[model samples]
Target: MRAVAIAAAAAAAKARRISGRLHATSSVRQYSIMISPHLKNITLTHSDSSIYSDDRSRPYGQPLAVPWSANQIRFAKARGSDVRPGNVIERKGKVYQVVKAQHSTQGRGGAIIQVELRDVDSGNKVNERFRTDEIVEKVFVEAKSFTYLYTDEESDSVVLMEPNTFVQLDVPKHLFGDSLAYLKDDITVSVELFNDRAMSASVPKRVTCTVVEAQVPMKGMGATPHTKKVLLDNGITVQVPPHVITGDKLLIDTTDNSYISRA
Candidate 1:
């Protein structure tokens, strides 16, 4: 019975020690939480801090995400005719892909060019507007020649193969809709790859197509033109001029999918 009592006492002592250690850890956590406000103010900007607070009107801060700055973006070449979509940009030593570009007036403000960029690694897209003359980074892309092999029957995806090589890749048809519009047999496209797979594609500046079917012109149509839509051979339909008819070739601006004029 004496030995049993001694064993019980020893176990109780160990438990007390563990309890003391846990209390010490909790006290440290509380201390850190008390000092966190000052640390946050030092580390985060005013806009960033506002995003973190419990204010419903402010933007929410993404936790544990790396911050990217638009000012750090560097342009490789001068802003000219070459500033087009699918161009990779290097900013703060990281790469981003340009998805779309639009220039518009900001309601009584000067013209601003809004750019949509997709993170090359995460495939996340963000929008930012800048002046038309603003310089941006243009990162070098490594693309190789490849050819379309066939479409997947089960998954509804198009399979591609490298020319003179047996390597093959399968991509969704929806993701390649724009490519399929002008993609011809054995045509070449600049494919941007991430982790050994094609993540995005870049096409030519402009392409010309013959209007298979054009609607009769709706003369004196109101503010909104009487838009009669016609389907193209690529399985895409777009509204065109009423004067256009079947077999009339037309040049289209592929960027905006807008009709230019009769070819």
Candidate 2:
């Protein structure tokens, strides 16, 4: 509770200053990304030269080499070229996880780093572009394991607890998207944190799902591999092979809800 209050106060106090300092570059953009049903608006701009990257410290566009661990935080300033998907950054005093990043070169405008960022607290998202040479405040976050607790519908967050210490965190639910359906009690989730705050979370790449109700395939559709929609215990309906029947277990790709194979 104390930490939440401090973070909110800090964000509110500095929000105006960050906005005042950043003029929407003719290139800056605002985006409303829906990683979940709760995402909201976004805005961004570049900081002044004072906070630009220290070129001599590292080569341009080199990715961070940190490994995953618990309760550790590392911070650095790097050029936009060095940013990548899954990296956490602070904009307007709020932290965001980079969902996607792409490098593009214009015939004359030099290199641009296009990024999609998701707010760690609100699940809101934004898209912004940066000069390859522009300095960005990068929060080096690493994934730590936590046990899936349950969703707090009122708060729109998922509760998770550290395995050893039992410390709990409320991660924004939107980070999970449709994959949230795969969550089961005591399941392990990978959460990326900076300063003990969750910036992103993911479930296992594969999950076991039960075939509850499989629709019969029509004989007219032939040649192609036969598939039919089957409901899972978690209430998700996905296509499975014709042979799959009620009570059968199947491995599902959590990333895209695709059927893998019989489990």
Candidate 3:
């Protein structure tokens, strides 16, 4: 009878130990569930794919999967020698528009490429030097036809509308900078779109503008083809030939804002 009592006490202690282990497991699982959402948020905040990975110590285990429907930019890998002026490129995770690219070969060195870049969104300028064989990421943008609407004074943006769908979009003034002086209503302009966002706008290579005001040629100025400063209807000032006068229509090069000829 005593042996049976001892066996019963031992079985009761074993059952208690099993129950404790199951309770601990349940508590651990609940704790993990509670913390999982916070961990996910932290991962997303630090795991943006656009960030450049330069540190070797930090391990990015695997790339996050991107949806197939997401917009993807077209890019090509090319050497620094192949980059051209007016091309867009990605460098150190920043996008820059190439203003000018020059290649030179020195007597002692193999070759070098110099590039002047402007930050697409910040309007900052930077000069970069690269070896001829250095690789670069060249981005391609698509040009779409858009008609000039009116400038939004409140937002300080130029409004443009698509012809086919009449979809209106407001482009930041800084995107075109001084080039906006050439924009005119009802004129068709080319807007460079990247990832469905307007990156820049190009005015017609040649535009006709009426002379709103002109300074008369000075009498004493020698006959060395003296030029006079004239203001166009768009408020841009340019030097025109002495023959140009008020109300005269003149052909101007929008690229350089220079006088071309009498229209």
Give the top-scoring candidate (lDDT).
2
Residues 1-263 of candidate 3: C-alpha lDDT, one tens digit per residue: 99868855755564444334432312222111011232221111122222323333433333222333353447889899898887888899988888889998888988999899988778788999989899999888878999999899898888999999999988877777678888887988888877887766778899999999987766786775668789999999999888888999999999889999999
- Show the colliding residue pairs in model 1: 74-137, 88-139, 216-242, 217-242
The reply for model 1, stretches above 4 Å from the true place, is: 1-85, 89-96, 100-115, 119-124, 128-139, 153-157, 171-180, 208-212, 217-229, 239-243, 260-263
Model 2, 6-106: lDDT tens per residue?
A: 85565555545544544333343232111212212222223232222333243323322212343243768888999898888877788888889999999
Candidate order by lDDT, decreasing, is 2, 3, 1
Model 3 residue pairs with clashes = none
Model 3 per-residue lDDT at 29: 22
Q: Which has the higher lDDT value, candidate number 1 or candidate number 2?
A: 2
Q: Which ten residues in a row have the lowest lDDT in candidate 2?
A: 32-41
lDDT digits (tens) for residues 112-216 of candidate 1: 877787766565678877676767666554576677666676986667777777688765555453655766566555566644655566445455666666566
- TM-score-wise, the better of 1 and 3 is 3
**Separate clash counts for every candidate:** 4, 0, 0
